[model samples]
Target: MRTSLQFIFLLVYASVAACCQGQEVTISPDVVYGHKSGLAMTCDVFTPEQDANGAAVLFMVSGGWFSNWSPPEQTQHMFKPLTDKGFTVFAVRHGSSPKFSIAEAVDDVRRSVRFIRGNADRFEVDPDRIGVFGMSAGGHLSLMLGTASDEGNAESKDPVEHISDRVNAVVAYVAPTDLRVMAKDAPDRLPAYDRFPALEIDAKSATADSPIIFVTADDAPTLLLAGAKDDLVPISYSRNIEAAFEKAGVTSELIEFENAGHGFGGEDAKKATEAMVNWFVTHLDK
Candidate 1:
């Protein structure tokens, strides 16, 4: 005989296991996209069980420049909203901080896009209809993909490098737009950033890494979701970038949650998720 709480726990666990065992989506875990220092850079692919819309979304698995891996099944809930809409999702993990700098992480993710694009047919997705979504440091990387992506080098020896990295749409939550400002002010004003060695970049590197610095007329349509009360990343970052996008005649929108902090909750989180799905569906049309 087991206690009610224990019985309920078992039921929940069983349900989760069933979900990952190929009920709702087909998950291909630990797919290596690139390598650094001999370690493989990887991403987990989640394809809907039915009615896949032929579009793809890449979710950056980053926080404070640190990328961590978790069991792919555990992340299904985070991607359910998109997957349910028949969108294939990629959980892209970049080279992490302390071991890898922000620049390296950017390169890793860019290579991921190239790899995915090069093998789009294998995944049953449109090579040109990819979108990106992330939050916090992940959000910053998402913006980087949206603003700084480029056509591939035709002369590159690696075949993956011959495919473009450009994304069609982007949704970033609580992202830092300007690394230059962060490098100059974050050390003193936001000492919390000091623990992440990736933010220790020099002015030139900061300028090169900042997403706002790379925005152009050809950039992807971007949707920025920010918390008005976010202390970790100010809302002004989103506002400024939105203004820049407007000036450049790029399609961009900013939505701020007044009562939220660095992360959203309850209705704010729900609203943000809906906005992201809608953005991708609109911009990544087949």
Candidate 2:
């Protein structure tokens, strides 16, 4: 039997492929954003053919901390909802786990943002209006960008490093907020940690990687969508982050699909996608 997470992934993929047919968008595939250990890190840029919005959104192409690549043309349908609304999208791939740790993945994504922001003019996007969206491990990465961003290193030699990584808004689905719960010796440690070596960490390291630890008043406005029936990442993760956002006076909302699992399908999928598009429109379209 497939796990809830796996099932949801397939369902969401099939639903998106089925509904997002014939979207007119220009795709620039494998644009190098940065380099890691002499390897080029890349993102596929999707620009709407009409009504091109200056704002940009980065989609973290990660699942279970494993960043995989597919032909941009094959996956372009997945971004139709955002493109239909005239939002430019960048599908960002981070360094995969088993070879890279969660901490390294975070660093890779942060660098990707810096590169995109520094080259915003080339991409025809507003540097200050960037947003991010992801699901599962990707969602966790999105939250990391939202809460732990810096104002850029002015003295850095690389021009890209001089641009801030902070995003204007965030939308995460079923993200793990407090990674400390996955500490190796924790009583409630994730049961499948062995399968995702990225979660193999001590309590101290987990705390360092947890998005909840970095939340502050100035963090990006965030929208979290979660399935109440999610078995992989409990709904409490989103609930806790929502509470933290509220306490910090940040604009945030959490929408729960009571009947869905780790991923949404059918009406729930449509609702979540709409909610995501609207959140970016309200926050990034200023």
* Winning candidate number (TM-score): 2
User: In candidate 2, which residue ranges exceed 4 Å CA deviation?
Assistant: 1-23
- Which residue pairs overlap in candidate 1's backbone? none
What is candidate 1's local distance difference test score?
0.83
Over 4 Å off, model 1: 1-23, 184-189
Residue pairs that clash (backbone atoms under 3 angstroms), model 2: none
Indicate the worst ten consecutive residues by lDDT in candidate 1. Answer: 1-10
lDDT for each candidate structure: 0.83, 0.87
Clashes of each: 0, 0
Q: What is the Å distance of residue 97 in model 1 from its true position?
A: 0.2
Tell me the lDDT of model 1 at 222. 98
Q: Tens digit of lDDT per residue, candidate 2, span 100-163?
A: 9899999999999999998889999999999999888889999999999998999999888888
